[model samples]
Target chain A: MAGHKIDGTAIAKSIRERIHAQIKEAQKLNPRYKPCLKIVQIGERPDSSTYVRMKLKAAEEAGILCELVHLPSSITESELLLQIQNLNNDHSVHGILVQLPVPNHISEHTVTSAVAEEKDVDGFGTMNIGELAKRSGKPLFVPCTPKGVMVLLKESGVDLRGKNAVVLGRSDIVGSPVSYLLKNADATVTVCHSHTQNLSDFVRRADVVVAAIGKPGFVKGEWLKEGAVVIDVGTNYIPDTSKKSGQRLVGDVDFDSAIEVASQITPVPGGVGPMTVAMLLQNVVDATTAYFDKQKARHVVPLPLKQLSPVPSDIAISRCQHPKLITQAAGETGIAAHELVPFGRVSN
Target chain B: MAGHKIDGTAIAKSIRERIHAQIKEAQKLNPRYKPCLKIVQIGERPDSSTYVRMKLKAAEEAGILCELVHLPSSITESELLLQIQNLNNDHSVHGILVQLPVPNHISEHTVTSAVAEEKDVDGFGTMNIGELAKRSGKPLFVPCTPKGVMVLLKESGVDLRGKNAVVLGRSDIVGSPVSYLLKNADATVTVCHSHTQNLSDFVRRADVVVAAIGKPGFVKGEWLKEGAVVIDVGTNYIPDTSKKSGQRLVGDVDFDSAIEVASQITPVPGGVGPMTVAMLLQNVVDATTAYFDKQKARHVVPLPLKQLSPVPSDIAISRCQHPKLITQAAGETGIAAHELVPFGRVSN
Candidate 1:
């Protein structure tokens, strides 16, 4: 509120534009490049249907292919798994995302894990989490919400290095992963949860406060530092008699007073909400590019407990200096040291 | 010097005593339950060898089994992989650590990943990192350096919640992970590294500073706020005419000046140093416990990307009380429906 409002909707549109351009360029280079996503829906929930419909609309608008898989609520867990396996092995699919809150009858982990790491564009793959922890990526997709938040920050001229950041919440999707993403960017971050003894103490010390707590109007301006950056990740809604829908979408922050104190803030419905879809589109474009390149995206791979898997047995490589070199370290002979790159990678 | 000196040696000794007591109790319960760690050393890097010896001595003193597998510098990476695999499959090896700087010819990831997550008591395994990131490890084994720092802060009576923490470094081993750990503990953390612009401005704002840059005396006291807690993590040695060895160990912080303004400080040799070994020993103990518990340690399983592994599927049970005797109206069954009561599992 203190700073100018960051227009996340417009920004998301711009991001989608960039991704669209990237996909267009890829298509020029490879005729086979088609950004295709397979979305698996598990039940007849109305909310889930609307969300999928919006995604399909966005995909079409972006000139990407969207395939939907519908399953009954009574479907056996094993049967759903078989479907995921078939998709995982399918070469045509670049991204696979099974809708969340899967009927509450199926184990979420089993369903989430069924999507191969490379195809998990939702950034929920175990290996991707591993890589993100290492500041590395294979599935290469950062989650939609966090990625959108990062884009918003960078585009809005918020420098993360050495900034004291307080994230309110620890949900896997928004809070926890965002903390990791921020740290990877060199920001000092603290995550406050229900068990945190006092929340205001952490908030006042923060240069950036990320409110991901699900409670409506849970954070107030008094808890914020003057000129702080505020990102509201909450989408909690409260019932309103004045509205036809009988509800209003609100964020976790007390926007009225907070806007007066904070240097920059994100609005709720028009803010992070729009960016998630944009970020999802970005992932699709990335998968499309990786597909055409005949390459697999990188993701974190968790090894089994106490079981070491031997790496690919061998690879060939060479390193040396030409005869013109004149140092003990660099032999004068054109024939120099032949060495296999360690970690099977060449360091420049 | 301003800050009250934090006695790392004393704290480390106390921690070691606790671990020894734990080992004694465990042995009483299960006579054959001896903690064991296999450390693989490649080449004669003095630093690596010293660390290995220190760890080995500490493990032995704790009444734990310890083995050192020293490999020649010329050994091919494949051969090292085979060695790690052999150890991974060995039940006797509760924890496995391949010493760092494992030759330029070898990949550190290869070696670290090769040690099954269960045996990665050093907390460098991909799964270990993922588990730490997820904040799901019960009795989680944090990477040693960071864990040591956390222990030091805890022992010194510093409350991390709401504290403004500035960590100076982004190394895989200490800076980055420590930032994550501190953030998890509820401190508003800021991480600074080479890419960070306006470095001093960031440091001056912190309530606490963790100086981990390898540079000797890079951070001055004036860079810190008055009453700020300082945790020096540097182990750098610089020329010193007064020392018999012609060099002295200096921390990243200008200790003389920082001590004056800081409320608490950790010394060079005594600070953060002993704690690393203590944490490693603790991890070994944890591995032993986990092995006997017969549960898949998530810390040992690295999710390849952001996605988790497929969970064991859940079956559809009608929500009506008529369908589930486990619940009335099947409302909130409250019981973890998927909870497995394995052969050896205990339930309340």
Candidate 2:
């Protein structure tokens, strides 16, 4: 039986459309309101350039202001850090992302740590990852790929609670964070890595399998539990002379065989890729909304009062003061007019 | 078949003796070299007092300066925070520990985080635990209980590499950090909690099991794989009419039943309990040694030299300068004479 294919492209598109509409709606109330993302790219790596371009185009399509700050390969580590600090201090930029695979001369750890935690859209900093691992931690923003994987799982209607989840690979970016997310969702999570023995024995019993080992077709269909949900995060290139590029993108799971057993599965190229960009855009929107909400909440005005000459009884004092309407109070607290619900009139 | 009892009490005693000897050796060179621990205990909860006394006795026995600052239960959170800050700023206090169960009014999170990360001997702070969770993170100090568990595992001759290990808890204290440690050591780890289904199936295939769910005898011996190693961290008090106190301490695993099937097991009263105080004293010593090492490292003196009229070739310049003996150089670099091994005569 052919398993149901998870249409990641459609899901990602719908999410992007929702984000675009939300941004447009926010702009309608305040024309100046706009979510902004700044990407810091170093060197002229072809792959890095391609990813940056994809992000730029996606951000623009989602009504976000995206800017690329490309620097020369010869830039010193201190100079790179200064650039990130400037972006961090800029109130206009809601999200800051430092493209990975930085020049060998520059330390990736230092560069990633330089991004302010609040504006760290990539969420690769120690603070964010550390919080994600904590049992009751509240991270400001989860990493894009892991966050996207969670969305795909939810969209597929998989109830993670009490389910056995086996995560292959333990990369800080994908495997570790996703396992933490699965555990946080109440799934019994087993993290299998390069050193894991009897790896198939683990996958064979898992209710859900997330493969991110970066090896093409590393996970076989026979290893998966029948009707299991498979989300492959690997993006490996294998030789395919029939293709124009002479190579084709594949995931850790062999799709042909997995589709025969999995109840739901995501394809390689279009699966996790598009969702990453969508989640990045969503994080920017959320940060911008939070910024504006804080600004509006600060607009609360103190009510003026007439001082009485003599102190009155508590009942008399309460009767003397005039109370504002519930709607007026709601407005003062930054609640939108459309959000207010009136439950009967206040009695005198 | 009966399993070997992991005598944590004997292991802890040996470790404390080594620490005591090390401190005495250090004092031989510098009489003032002393590791100090300041434990801030809120209220007078009998259990808390008992634990504090155990820690104090263990620390003093290990040649550490232990001090207890007993605060009233009525103290506000801010006041408690102020006390922690004072301890944090005190260079003389190498380790600062705040006893748990502060008070109903005080926030435990706030109190735990208030202790400086450097002086956090208990290792309950977010920064320390966060570092522990990272792939290559070098935490200043790991939490005592988890650290003790690792020591017990090591003492039992359990090689974690490529092993299947099941952790039966997901707490910020024990289960979580130990799982991370095991994973870091290349063990395939599955973390099971209250929401886990088929928990016995997970434990049945494990090479090692660590139970810290606080439930007495929750893990059955039948669930254990033959010859599996068990590290029970539970300390539960059960009514025992045969005991003088009318109660007895038990672990998450039924020791009598577990021993019959397991290769090794830790008994509740003498197991993880004693190791906790031993690890705390070790952390205090480690912190004090680090403090002095940093001070000693900064004692390097600049060598003065005469300027040459004309720049010489590298070979010519090397022949003109006087060279100090290797021992002299080692001394300047804070290496003790006993630590140095002079290989030959340094080629004259």
Candidate 3:
């Protein structure tokens, strides 16, 4: 590591450790504090199965309980939804993930929408996605892979505010959601995809470049700005005669060229790949804990204030002020308002 | 004017004319057929009220009825939401629009979310936005200005597919959502914003550039590619002694130099400006038509089949299609029956 190589694996390990500590503490308060994850897999694809298997193993290593719910290829649409309804009602199954690319007879939208928003660990459900979209206006659980990417950036100590960031790919699963998260973090974000012209032009100007394209080695180092932070989200596998399994996994960035110019770079396997599943485990643990919180969080959200009728225009809630008050005081003292607010509280 | 100058005002007039024809046809079918729009204003912003009046006049000119629901500046949050709820439930009202930048007191999110998805002609609701985020998904109403940008591009006969496109803003109300629309329409899309480093480097390579930076003459023509299609979304007013109002509207691009180099460009005031309100009126009509198709459309959407338990391990959804029919076809073919099926599309 010439300058800085953001070790996603190490960062993920620290997060898992923190979560494990929280679990241990929670158990003391209540022995029933178990982090449980349930993955709903439809007709199987080898790649998906391998990914699901990796998640299960990772969850177990994190000391979280895992359950795999397998579905038949010939399963009917209503039956699949019924299973989701049951999972939604199950207090023990904290987080639920329905693997993608369902049968032609099924609708992915219907399947995704079926997962209760609280249990949507994959974060593809309509309500969950909608909540994420509106998160800047009000905070909500962000999607996992993007959440993991945010962790890697923050762990590396890069300032996100006002940073120009470009993301490759626009799939709802990664690109668009990541851009939204980056924007929410106060970073100026740009999303470029296949329809995008001259991809290198955008990449060369990025302070942070997130390459989520499924294509291997698509983001060349020359395409990057010198000393830029790089997060490689693609997990493309290519056949390799040298490997025992006749295959090897690589990322979207060209690692050799990237390491020379990057201020911080993540390696393919040890970087984003491990972090994705780790975040899922994190989501599962959070969902299980929240199940006990029940309607308390909802109740705590406060009623949406009295109707707009007969209300004075100047008296509307406007900026909720708890955070603004500190900023206002700092402003009078000539200190940056951000300096007054608690820093490093938003650990991913 | 060089070849790049597009008559946006003329195009908008044509689109508006087409909508008038549609409204007249609907009137023939039902005497009660009316494309009625409601404008809910919470504050007394001069510019916002001017915009509201423009929309109302446009609706009337296009053969649609309109009403203004004036709320005092001191309106309460719940009251505003209740008004939106009433508009949502009223079959007489085809579309609902709430003038933005409401008094600091009211929550934009709360107000936007309160509008029923069907009545949200502005297309700012969370559910509609979520729908906009998915593959093969279409929002009930695409936001006006961005949709207007598309109308201009299509009218100019620009082939969006495989073309390089860059947007110079990331506002959710414009840049971000519009980028998705451009990409979905098949142009490769890259969004460059304030966080971007060397913004010109990206602009220089664009086949198409949409300037929405809200800064007058912010994008220099030299940064533009030769023969580029320019769509300026910026509505900046610069103080000018030559103007009676002490100000004149200008777009983000330096139009003087841009017209000389570009194949097509939209002028500031008459270009995209007129198209915005036109799209709004169009959305009102669409909102009415959609209400008639809601139940029918939702019923056509099938549930997810993958969520069911005991999933098959062998066949993948994409790799194997119409399993039964393919299996039968293969069995008839007599060459290792039941395994091969063409993918992409399959009937239920």
Candidate 4:
């Protein structure tokens, strides 16, 4: 039986529509409210330009104000960092992203780290990645590609809880973060890389397979378990004499063979690729909402401090101050009562 | 047939001896060179005091200047933070650890994070834990329990490369970090926790099993694959009227049954307990050595900066400067030739 194909393009379109509606609602509340995204491209690399253009178009469609700042190849690392700093300081810009494969002179690590944690929509910075890796960490934004993969998994109606998930890469951008997401979702995730031995044995037992190794057809269909769900994150281009570009995009899975055995699969080019831009748009919207929420919260009146003679100890002062119930406080901050998990009476 | 005992107590002793000899050598060079550890204990919990006492004794035995600061339970978080700041600023203290189980009024997260990263020998802070989680991160110190577990595995001669390792529990201290360590060592790791369904299924295929779920005898021998290496990090206590304390320590795995099925295993009480204190002393020594190394490096002559007439761009200025070969630079920093992995000409 042929497997069902996960329609990422259609799913991304629906998500973009939701974002557009959300942006419209926000604008209705305050005409000045606009989610803004700034993309920094260091060089004129054709691939980088294409990706940036795609992001710009998607953001525009989603009612996000997307701006591209194209810097020359001769720009210095310090100059690039200065540009990022200016964007970081701008209150209008909610999301800032530095396109990858920056000039050799500019250390990618330094450039990515330069993005403010609040505005790091790409989620490549140490703080974001670190939070994603942590079990109890709350990352402001997850990297787009991994976030997109998770969306596909969710849309496909696959219950990750207690399932066996085998991630086929360990890259910081895709494999590592995705593994953490799966584990957090309660999947028994096993990360397999080049160093992994008997890779087929792992694939054969996996209930869900996410291949991001970037190799063309690295995972064979015969190696997959029957009725397994496959999410292919690879975007490798192999030579295709019939194609006008002389190459065709293929995923890490042997698609034709995998389609026959897998219960659900995501096709190359139209799968994980489209969802990335959609997720980026979503992250910008989320950041913009948070910014406004913080602004609203800033208006809250501060409690009058009652000073005691000789100044009591810090704990004594705190204990004397009556605090709002945690549930009430959470509600005031837009958190639903169901969303609050009380650990103890400290907040009571 | 019974499996061989891991003998963690003996291994830890040998490690302590190594640390002692190294400290003696450092002191011989300069009598002022002494590793110092400061452990802050809040409240008078019997278990906390016992653990702190054990650490103090072990650190002293390993030639480290160990100091315990006992604070009242009523002390506020700010006061405790102030004390930690003092230790952080103290040049004589190489390692600073805050004993766990602080009063409910004090946020453990805040207290742990307040410890300076360089002096956070406990490795519970966000920076250290985040670094530990990253793929290419260089954490200053791994948490003592997880570090000890790795040392046990190494001493037992188990090569983790491409091995199937199952880690039980997902606690940040032991389970999470140990899984990262195992994955970094090239093991295909599956982390199972309370929500995990059919946990036995994951364990039954493991080549190496690390149980830290804190439930006594949670993992049975039948759940483990024959000849698997087991490292139990649990220290659960159950009623034993026959003993004076009316309790006995047991591991997450049923020791008696596990020994019959496993190739090597760490017993309860004498196993992981001693190693924790040993690793703590080792971290202090390591920090002390790094401190002195930094001091020695500070004495190096600085390169004279050349100011050009036209005021060149940052990239141009950097490009004009000649950099020492990475091998030579690494050597100067005490990194051996074999330890350096050349990525590209950027370092040349």
Candidate 2 clash pair list: none
List the TM values for chain B, per candidate: 0.82, 0.85, 0.84, 0.87
Error of 3 at B125 (Å): 1.2
- Where does candidate 4 clash, by residue pair? none
Superior by TM-score: candidate 3 or candidate 4? 4
Estimate the lDDT of model 3. 0.78
lDDT score of residue A137 within candidate 4: 76
Q: Rank the candidates by lDDT, best first.
A: 2, 4, 3, 1
Q: What is the DockQ of each candidate?
A: 0.15, 0.20, 0.20, 0.21
Q: Compose the digit string of candidate 1's lDDT tens values, residues A272-319.
A: 888988888888787766555434333322222222356333231111
Per-residue CA lDDT of model 2 for B23-48, tens digit only, reads 99999988879999999999999989
Report residue A302 deviation for candidate 4 (angstroms).
Answer: 9.5
Q: Which interface RMSD does candidate 1 score? A: 15.1
**Model 3 DockQ, alpha carbons vs. true complex:** 0.20
Q: Lowest summed lDDT over 10 consecutive residues: which window, candidate 1 chain A? A: A339-348
List the candidate 4 regions with Cα displacement exceeding 4 Å: A72-83, A103-106, A295-348, B28-32, B74-86, B89-92, B295-348
**Which candidate wins on DockQ?**
4
Model 2, runs deviating above 4 Å: A29-32, A293-348, B28-32, B295-348
Error of 1 at B170 (Å): 2.9
Clashes of each: 41, 0, 31, 0
Best candidate according to lDDT: 2
Q: What is the C-alpha lDDT of each candidate?
A: 0.76, 0.87, 0.78, 0.86
